[model samples]
Structures are given as structure tokens and as C-alpha cells.
Target: MLDPILLWSGLVNGLLQGAIYALVALGLTLIYGVLHIINFAHGSLLMLAMYGVFLLFSQFGIDPYAALPIMVVGMFVLGYGLQRGLISRASHGRDENILLVTLGISIVIENLALFFFQGDTRTIDVPYAFDSLEVFGVFIAIPRLIAFAAALLIAGLLWLMIQRSDVGRAIRAVAKEKQGARLVGINVEHIYAVSYGVGIACLGAAACLLMPTYLVYPTVGHAFVLIAFTVVVLGGMGSFPGALLGGLLIGLCESFGGLFLGESFGQIGIFLVFIVVLLFRPSGLLGSRV
Candidate 1:
């Protein structure tokens, strides 16, 4: 039998990590929802943001948190341009064409990072990196907690934008009925660009929050992109709240599976749950049926 304390600790840690994963998953789902494209390069965009934070910290003495606003603006511009210059051209193409284009973009970005930053791993160390808080016999890493708070704040803001703002309504209108939106004078192309920009901005936020806890490398995005895809699929594609719930579920599975079944089985446990969900609830836990 597992020790109760150990189990509780794993659960707490899992929740914290899940918050970070939610950020990434939300970004991917947003892009998919609006653009109907899988964005194979989404993780590579995150890799770029991670490098941006690292450079700001190491070369300019800017803290990762302080650099977040700049990162968001810069990533938004890049994402907007990519949509306008490249992705928009393929928007009308078949799904395979869009997939190929995005895959190409991902490869280019990865190689470029490799050429400039090399394959060496990099990390940012802040004063709070090693700090922790204990509550009810459970220890929580302070950095993780901060990241969790930031994730929830961003998620809440996104929810508000989607629910209350005119731009958000426009985005939803385009996603739901592109032809009707265009007929009603909505610029579908521009909305697509804005949606992509927002998606990448989410990645930027995730990058800043994650730099304190993880190492950055050229290939790091590949693993994260896979995990993000798993989260999106598990939560149901295009479901915002579903992404959060799926992330927490995956995080808990990884944590508890590692504790009981061993570290190697952690990923397997997540996949097992994913498969079960697919078999029984194809639309995801909170997702609406298509």
C-alpha cells in the first residue's frame, strides 16, 4: 500500500504541473479551433519563446517574469506575420497540405535553433527556484505554485475574452461559421491571423513560466508538442475548459503512476487513460459531441 503522505504529495505536485500543461494545451486548442489547422509548429514557437526568455535573462539581465510582456508582443507579431505571409496561403488547401506546411515550418525552426543555440541545454535560475512551501505535511515548490497561479489567471482572462469581448465574439463567429461570418462583413482572414497570434502569445506566456523549472534545448519542443497534442485529444479538440481538465488528469496520472508503477510507466499510464477515454468518451470528458 502507498503511504498516504506520499500519495498526497504526488497529487499536489501533479496539480501544479498540470496548470503549466494547461497553458500549452490551451494554445494548441485555440489555434485548432479557429484555423482548423493542427499547427505542427506550435511547439517550435514555444521553443522560440523559451530562447527569448533565456536570452533576456542571460544577456540583458532581465528577469523571466519581467520579460513576459515583451515576449508576448514579439510572439504575437511573429505569429501574425506567419499567418499573413505563409499559413494564410495554405488556408484553403487540403488538411494534408496544411499539415505538410506546418511540419516544414517546425523543421526549419528546429534547425535554426540548433544552428544558433546549438543542442546544449539552457536554464534560468531565479532566487525562488529552490524555494518551497509546506501545507498540511505536503511540500509545494514556490516556482511551480507561481506558474500555476499565472496559468489560472491567463485562463480566466481568456475565458472572459471569449465570453465578453467583441473581438472574442468575432473569433467565435468565424470559427463557427466562416461563410456566414464573411457574409456579415467579418474579415475571416484577419480573424484567422488574430487567432493565431493569440495562440502563440499563450505559448510565450507558458515559456516564461516554465523557464524557471525546466531546461531549454533545440529538441525540447518535440516532447512538449507531443504532450500538448495528447492533452488536446484527451480533452477534445477545441474545448477550452476541457484542456484544463485533461491536463490535470494527465498530470495526476503521471505523478501517481510514477509513484506506484515506477517512473517508466508514468507515460504509459497517461496513454492508457487516453485510450480508455477514446474508447468510452470519444468527445472527451467535457467536450460536446460533433
Candidate 2:
């Protein structure tokens, strides 16, 4: 039997990891909610943002946290441009077309990074790399704590934006009824781009928060793609709060599973929970009826 302290530590770690997972999934869910398409390129975009943070830190000696605003704006521009200049033109009113386009984009991004960065894994060392916070006899890494706080703050802000902002209202209007939104002079195409940009912006924040503890490579995004999808599905696609809760739950499972089942087999728990959820509650924990 594991010590109670060990179990507590595992749970803490899992919650920390889950917060970052929620941050990552938030973008995917938001895009799906607004655009109604699965962005196969999301992981690739995350990979790109990680690279952006890496380059800034490596070349300019800037801290990852300090680069947050820069990355968010840059990614937003890239996402906006992609949506306005390519995705919209290519989508042609078909979700399948958007899927293909995003898939192609992912492939292109991976190859470009491979060609440019040569697939070498990169990591950053911050001043607080080894720092930790002691809480009730448990030591939690500072970076993990920061990630948890930042993720929650961003999620809250996003929820508020969606719930209260005028632009957000336009986004919802377009998401629910594009023709009606257009009739009301909501620049439907621009709203699509903005929504996509906001979705990608979340990844920018995620990359910065993750860089202090995570490594990056051309294929790093691949590792996250599966987990992100799981969170989205488990949380109920297009539901922000659902994604948040699902992420934390998945994180706990991974943590406890690793403790009891060993590292190699730990992931079995995630799959088990995923299957069980699908079998019983397909709509998800907080998701509405499908």
C-alpha cells in the first residue's frame, strides 16, 4: 500500500498537470464551438507557439513568462490570417473540407519545423527551474503552480469575454446563426477569423506557461494531440467548463494510475475512463444532450 503522503503528492501533481491540459483543450473546444470544425492543426499550432517561446528565450534571453503577450498577439495574428486568407476560402461550406485543410496544415507545419529546426528537442532553464513551494508538507513545483493559476485566470477571463463582451456576442451570434448574424451586419467572416484567432491565442499562453517545465520539438505537439482530444471529448466538446473539469479528472487518473499501475501501464486508466464515459454519458459531465 502506498503511503498517504505519496498519494496526496500524486494528486497534487495531477491537478497541476491537468490545469495545463485544460488550457490546451480550451482552444480546441472554443474553435469547435464557434467554427464547428475539428482543428487538426491545433497541436501543430501549439508546437509552433512553443517554438516561438523557445526562440525568444534562447536568442534574446527573454523569460518565457515575459514573452506571453508577444506570443499571444503573434499567434492571434497567425490564426486570424490563416482563417481569413486560407481556411474560409477553402472550407467552401463543408466541414470535411475544413478537416482536410487543417490536417494538411498540420503536416505542413511539422515538416517545416523539421526542415528548419532539424527535429532537435529543445528545453529552457529558468532561474526558478528548481524552485518549489511547500504546502501542508507537500512540495509543489513553482512552475506547475504558476501554470495552474494562469490557466484558471485565463479560463475565467475567456468565460467572461464570451458571456459579457460585445465581440463575444457577435461570435456567438455567428456561431449559432451565421446568416442571421450577417443580416444584422455582424461581419460574419471577420467574426470567424476572430474566433479562430482567440482559440489559437490560448495556445500561445499555454506554450509560455509550459516552457519552464516542458521541452519542445517538431513532433512534441503529437504527444498532446491525443490528450487534448480526450479532454475535449470527456468534457463535452464545445463546453469550456466541461473541458476544465474533464482535464482535472483525467490528470488525477493519470497521477493515481501511475502510482498504482506503474508508468508503462498508467495511461490505461485514461483510456478506461474515456471508454466508460462514452458508454454511459456520451454528452459529457457538463455537456448538454446531444
Candidate 3:
């Protein structure tokens, strides 16, 4: 039988990891909800943000946590410009076209990272990297705890923004009915850009949270693309609540799977869950059928 302490530890770690996954998914779901674009570039954008964190830390001696606002604002601007100048114009308001454009953007980003940073994996050496907190004999990394808290806080803030802000209302209007939103004096295109910017901004926060423990590389985004998509689909394409729940569930699956099945086969659980959800509950746990 598995030790209860080890099991609890795995569960806690999974929950922490899942929170970050959900954070990544939030941006993706938001973009899909508002702009109706798959954003194939989402993972690439995340990798870019991670690189930004790496550069800021290595070159300027800035702490990853301290770089949070910088990365968020910088990514938001990048996202806004991409949507306004490139995606919006290049896509011609077609989903397939947008998909291609985003894929192209992903390719470009990966190549740019390769050209600039090379393909070697990079990691930061923060003082607290080796620190941990023990609770009832289950030890948790301090970084993991901080990440968990930040992820939830950011998710809560995002929910509030969507629910209470004027710009958020315009975003919702555009998401529901672009023509109607335009008729009401809401700038549909600008809302699209803003929504895209906010989505990418989530990645900035995620990068900051992940950098203390995770390594970065030109193709690091690939590690997350499948999992992020799984979270989004398992939660429902456009449901933020679904994303949050799905992330936690997937995280648990990963932790327990790794514990029992060993590293080689551990990922089987995530795939299994994805397959089951697709077969039985394509709308996701909290999402409404489209």
C-alpha cells in the first residue's frame, strides 16, 4: 500500500501545478471566448514570456517575482499590437485564417527564440529555490506555495475584471454579438485586441510563477501545449470556471499517475482523462453546450 504521507504530498504538489496550468488556460479560453480564435500561438507566447523572465533575471539581476508586473505589461502590449496590427488584418475575420496566422506566429516565435537564446535549456538560481515548507509531514516547495497562491489570486482578479469592469462589459458584448456591440458604440475590434492582450497577460503572470522552479528553452512551449489544450477542452472551450476545475483534476491525475505508474507511464492518466472527457462530456464540466 502507498504511504499516506507520500500520497498527500503528491496531491498537494499536483494541486499547485494544476493552478499554474489553469492560469495558462485562462488566457487561451478568454481568447477563444472573445475572438473565436484557437490561438495556436498561445504556448509560444508563454515560452516567449518565460524567456523574457530569464533575460530580465540573468542580465539585470531582477527577481522573477519582482518581474511579474514588467512581464505582464510587456506581454499585454505585445498581444495588443499583434492582434491590432497583424492578426486582425491578416485573418480577414476568418477563423481558419486566424488559425493559420497564429500557427505562423508560433513558428516565428520558436525560431526567434532559437536564434536569440539558442536551444539549450535555461534555469534560474534563486536563493529560495531549494526551500520548502512542511505541513503534517508533507513538504511543499516555497515557490510552489507562492505559485499556488498567486495563481488563485490572479484567477479571482480576472473573474472580477470580467464581471465588474466597463471594458470587460464591452468585451462580453463583443463576445456575444460583435455587430450588436458595435451598434452600442463599443469598439468591437478594440475589444478583440484588449481581450487578446488580457489573455496574453495571463501568460506573463504564469511565466513569473513558473520560472523559480521550471526550466526554459526555445521549444519549452511544447511541454505545455498539449496539457493546456486538454485543460481547455476538459473544462469547456470558453469556460473560465471549467478551466480552473479541469486544471486541478488534471494535476491530481498527473501526480497520482506519476506516483503509481512511474515517470515513463505517468502521463497516461492525463491522456485517459482527455479521451474520456471528449467521449462523454465534450462540453466540459462547467461549460454550456454551444
Candidate 4:
């Protein structure tokens, strides 16, 4: 049996990790839901966002958090243009084509970063990076706690946007039937572009939030993309609520798995859960049948 204290530590740590996974998966899920695109480039975009923050802070002495709004806006525009110019051409239900395009984009971004940054890993060392609180005789990492809170808060806001907002309704409409949406006075193209942009913006947000803890590098995005996809698939493609649950679940698994099985095996265990979910749940905790 696990010790009570270790269990508590794992629980909080799992929640924190889940929060990070949720934010990362949110962008991928959003694009998947609204645009029916897998967005393999999402992780690459996240890396770019981190680099963006890094450049701003390192060169201009701006705070990493302070550059967030700009990065979000810039990423949105970047996503919009990329989708409009490349992804839009793939059209609906073209899963293979969309995947190829996004994958290509990821490769391009990764290579560009490699060419520029030369594979050096870097992290944004914010004030109190190592700070944490003690609870029940357990040490909780402050940055992770903050990241977890931010992730949950944003996830909640995303849920509201999808379930309650007008734009959210339009996105759903477009997702269900693009032609019908066009007939109903919705500009499918614009919505598609904007949704893709929003997806990138989510990546930007995650990057900014993660700066204090994780390192920034050309291939950094690759490290976490698998976990992000696992969360998206396990939670339900295009389901923000599912993403949150999936993220937290995976985080907890990683925490406990690391404690018992070791960090390397922890990730493998998470992948196995993903496989099990696919075999049994298929649509994930919240995804719908297409």
C-alpha cells in the first residue's frame, strides 16, 4: 500500500501536471472540434510561442508574462494565415490531407528553430521559480500550482465560450455542417481561420504559462506533444471538458507512476491508458461520434 504522505504529494503533483496537459491539449482539441483538423503542428506552435516569449524577455528585458497578450495575438494571426493559405485548401473530412499539411508545418517550424537556436535548451527563470508551499507535510511546487490554476481557469472559460457564447454556437454549427453553416449566414471560411487562430493562441498561452518551469528550445514542443494528444484523444476530440479531465487523469497517473514505476515508465503507463481508452471508450470521455 502507498504511504499516506506520498499519496498526498502525488495527488497535488498530478493535479499540477494535469493542468499543464489540459492547456496544451485545449488548442489541439479546439481545432479538432471546430475545423476537423488534427493540428499536429500544435506542439511546434507551442515551441514557437515559448521562443517568442524568450526573445522578447531576453532581448528587450520584458517579463515573460507581460509578452503573453502579444504572443496570443500574434499566434492567432499566424494560425489564421496558415490555415487560410494552407489548411483551408484541405477542406472538410480530408483527414489525411490535413494531417499531412499540419505535420509538414510542424517539421518546418522545428527545423527553423533548430537552424536558429542550435538545439540549446533554455527556460524562463521567473522570480520565485522554485517557490512552493507546504501542506500536510508535503512540498508543492509553486510554479506548477500556478500553472495548474491558470490551466483550470482557462479551461473553464473555454467551456463557457463553447457552451454559452454566440461564437461558440457558430463554431459548433460549422463543425456539424459547413455547407449548412454557410447557408445560415455564417462565413465558414472566416470561422475556420479564426478557430485555427484561436487554437494557436491557446498554444501561445500555454507557452507563456509554462515558461517559469520548463525549458525553451527548438524541439521542446516534441517532448510534450504526445501527452497533449493523449489528453485530447482520451478526453474526447473537440471536447474541452474531456480535455480537462483527461489532463488531470494523465497528470495523476504520471505522478503516481513515477513514484512507483519511475518517470520513464510513468509516461509509458500513460500511453497504455490511452491505448485502453481508444480500445474501449473510442470517443473518449466526452467526444461524439462523427
Candidate 5:
């Protein structure tokens, strides 16, 4: 029989970890839903945000939490420009071209970091870095708990914006039918840019949230981007809530699987779940069929 305390600890840890994954995956799903493009560079944007947080903290002594707004604004502008300047043009071409373009962007960002920052691993020193809260006999890291709360709050706000706001309506319209949205007088290109900006904004928030617990490195995004893709697919490509569910599920699988099987086997468990989900429900748990 499994140790109850260990199981509880794993569950708590997994939920917190999954919350961050959900934030990242939600961004990817939003972009894919509207633009029909998989942003291979999403993780690179996240890496940039991590570096941004690091710089702000190291140079000006700004706290990562306090620096979040600036990071979000900066990343949003960068994402918007990137969409308008480069991605927009490439998007008109074949899917293969779009994939190649995003992949190229990722490579550029990674190499740029390597050139400037080298391959060193860096992390931020924060007050809550090692603090934990015990709840019902389970100890949860404070930083991860904060991240979990932030993730849920952001997800809720995004869901509300998509469902209730005018811009959200336009975004949804475009995602549903691009030509129809255009015929209805919506500036499709601008909406596309805004959508991409929103996606990157999520990454910015995630970067700050993760900095206290994780290290920043040139190749850090490679692992996250893969996990984000897996979450996006498992959650159902365009489904918002589905991403959250998928993230938590993957988090639990990883934590428990690692405890029982081994650290390396945890990823195997995630892939196994992915394969099962694909075979049974290709549309994802919440995604609707066209």
C-alpha cells in the first residue's frame, strides 16, 4: 500500500506545478484557436520573460512579483510586433511555412540568449523561496502556492474576458470564421496581433511566477514548450478550461508516477496518458468536433 502522507504531498505538489503548466498551455491554446498557428517560440518568449525578471531583480532590486506588470507590458508589445511584422506575412503561406517560421524564431531567441547570457543557470533569491505551509498534514511550498493562486485568477479573468467582452467576441468570431469576421468589419490582422500578444502576456506572468522556484537558462524553454504542447493537445486544442484540466492531470501523473516508478518514468506516464487520450478522445476532453 502507498504511504498516505507521501500520496498527499505528491497530490499537493502536483496541483501547484500543474497550475503553472495550465497558464502556459492556455496561452498556446488561445493562439492556436484564433490564428491556427502553433507558436513554437512560445517557450522562448517565456525564457525572455524569465530573463527580464532576473534583470529587473538584479539591477534595480525589484521583486519578481512587483516586476510582473512591467514584464507583461513588455512581452505584450513584443508579441504584438512580432505577429504584425513577421508572423502575419508567413501565416498567409502554408502550415509548413508557419511551423518553420516559429521554429526559426525559437532558434533565434535561444541563440541570442546563448550569445549574451551564455549557458549559465540563474535563479532569483526571494523571501518565500524555501518557505512552506502545512495544510492537513501536507506541506506546500509558498512560492508554488502563490503561483497556483495567480494561475487560477488569471485563468478566470481570461475566461471572463473571452465570454463577456467585445474584443473577446471579435476574437471568438475570428477563430470561428476568419472570412466571416472580416466581412463583419473586424480588422482581422489587428485581432490576430492582439491574440498573440495575450498569449505572450500569459507567458510573462508564468515566467515571474516560476522564477523563484526554477532556474533561467538559454535552453530552459525547450523543456517547457514541449510540456505546453502536450498540455494543449491533451486539453483539447482550443478549449480554455480543458487546458487547466489537462495541466492538473499531467501534474498529478508526473508527481505520483515519479514517486512510485522513478523520476525518468514520470514522463513516460505523461506520454502514456497522452496516447490514451489521443486514442479515446482525439478532440480532447472538452474540445468540440467541427
Candidate 6:
């Protein structure tokens, strides 16, 4: 018997998954917006945080959830340093160079994971891993719910920062016109570092939020990174809100595609949507050339 309830549950689960993808993709879009770099290493950074949480739990007996703050702070500093020292210094008329360097960095990180973790899969076994709450007669998994909520919270915070704060305004200014920003005495290099830091912090935060429900594998970042990239392209490279909506839309498509087509085709369905979106809206839903 095909249960209508199960179908609805699948829809919610898909949305939850989408929420995590959106979180990571938004970070990707931000970096791309300001830095104009694809940041192939962003996914590896996510893997690093995942491993960071895994080791913290194995060594210190701390819950991965409880270690969220530490991961975010650590990754933020790592990103800032990477940008300030490596990216900023090398980004003089050499965007493609940075891309290749970051891709190489990602390869190294993945290999390190393989060497250390030995291709074994691991996951955090939290009590609430599969727990759920009933909403409007539908059951929603707690991890997904928390992840989804965190997605919104982070998005809101990001918007507030960009629209309100001094540093945030500087980021926007630099993104719009680097020379103009320099005319106003805004440090373009520092702004780039700050934006990159926020972007990387978001990836780490997503890793911690997803630890309870996801397995820790060397290549786990590979799975979501493509989806994140697709979301970024669909949402518009420089558009933050576009990333969120694109993620959610992709989520719904995956859920419904699996329901109607097959589970194996769900990801294929997202790429198909990407194809269609690109064919029609190359500039994206909200992208405006700055």
C-alpha cells in the first residue's frame, strides 16, 4: 500500500536536505559574489569541519552539536587566514590562478582524509538523530528540522550583517565597485577576507548541524558540493537570496522527482532543472551586474 503519509514525509525530508544544501550554497555564492572565484576548496573545508567535529567527540567526549561554536570559530579563522595570506596576495589579475590553487588544496584535503580515516565511513550517533516532531499531521525529523531552522536563522543573520553592519556594508561596497570602495577608504583586501571568512564559517556550521544525521566520509563533501554549486548558478552567482530559493526549489524537485521518477533520479532531476534555468535565465532570478 502506498501511504499518502509517507509521500508527504518524503517531501519534508527532501526540504530538510535542501535546507542544508542551501546553507552551504549561500556561502559559496557569497564568496563568488565578492571574490569572483569558484572556490573549489570550499567543499574540502566542509569535510575538514566534519572531521573536526568527529575528532572532538571521539577525543573529548563532547557532543558534535555542542561543539558547533568551536567549529565555526576555527573555520572562520582558517578562511580569513587563507584569504589574507594566500588568496589576497595572489589575486592580482589572476582569478584563474586562485581557482586552480584552491582545487589543488581540495585534492590535498581529500587525500589527507583518505590517509587518516582510511576510507571508512563514520557518523555521530546522537539520541535525536532520527527523532521527529509532528506538524500539521506530518512527522518531521528533528535533525532536519533543526538544520532547516538554522538555515533560516543563518540566512537572516547574513542579510542583517550585509544590510546593517559597517563591515557588511564594506563587503557590499567592495563587491559593487572595488575602486570606488577604495576611493572611500574602504580596505578592499580586508573586506574580501571578511566575506571569505563568513562564507567558510557557514560551511563549517553546516557540517556541525548535519553531523547528527549524516555520515562522516572523506568524500561526503563531494556529494553536496555539486548540488551547492548548481544552486549557486541557478540562484545567480552574486545573489544570496537566490541561493536560498534555488536550494529550496531544488529540494522540492528532488523530492517530487524521486516520488514520481525514482530515488536514483532525484539528483539527476536537480541538474536537469539547472539546465533549464540556465537556458532561460543566465543572469539568474535576482542577479544584477555590479
In terms of lDDT, model 2 sits at 0.92
Report the error of model 6 at residue 88, Å. Answer: 2.7
lDDT at 76, model 4: 90
Model 5 lDDT tens row, 213-253: 89999989888888889999998998999999998888888
CA lDDT of each candidate?
0.89, 0.92, 0.93, 0.86, 0.91, 0.86
lDDT of 2 by residue, 1-290 (tens): 77888988989989998998898898899899899999999999999999999999999998999999999999999999999999989889699999999999999999999999997999998989879989878999898899999999999999999989999899888878998999999998899899999999999999999999999999999877789899999999899999999889899888888988999898889889989998889888777796
Task: Kindly report which residue stretches of model 2 are placed more than 4 angstroms away from their true locations once superposed.
Answer: none
What candidate 6 gets wrong by more than 4 Å, as runs, is: 1-3, 91-93
Instruction: Give a tens-digit lDDT track for model 6, residues 98-143.
Output: 8987898899999999999989999877887879889867978788
Sort the predicted structures by lDDT, highest score first: 3, 2, 5, 1, 6, 4
Question: Model 5: how far is 210 from its true place, Å?
Answer: 0.2
Separate clash counts for every candidate = 0, 0, 0, 1, 0, 0
Where model 4 places Cα greater than 4 Å from the true spot, the runs are 90-93
Error of 5 at 242 (Å): 0.8
Deviation from native of the Cα of residue 18 in model 5, angstroms: 0.4
lDDT of 1 by residue, 1-290 (tens): 77889989989988888888889999899899888889999989999999999999999989988988998889989998888789778656567887888888899999999999999999987888989999889888888898999998998899899879988999999989999999989998899899889999999999999999889999888878888899999999999999989988888988888887888877888899999998999988777899
For 67-174, candidate 4 gives per-residue lDDT tens digits of 878888999999999998887686454778888989999999999999999999986667878998999999987877777787788778878887898888898899
lDDT of 3 by residue, 16-118 (tens): 9899999999999999999988989999999999999999999999999999999999999999999999999998998999999999999999999999989
Model with the higher TM-score, candidate 2 or 4: 2
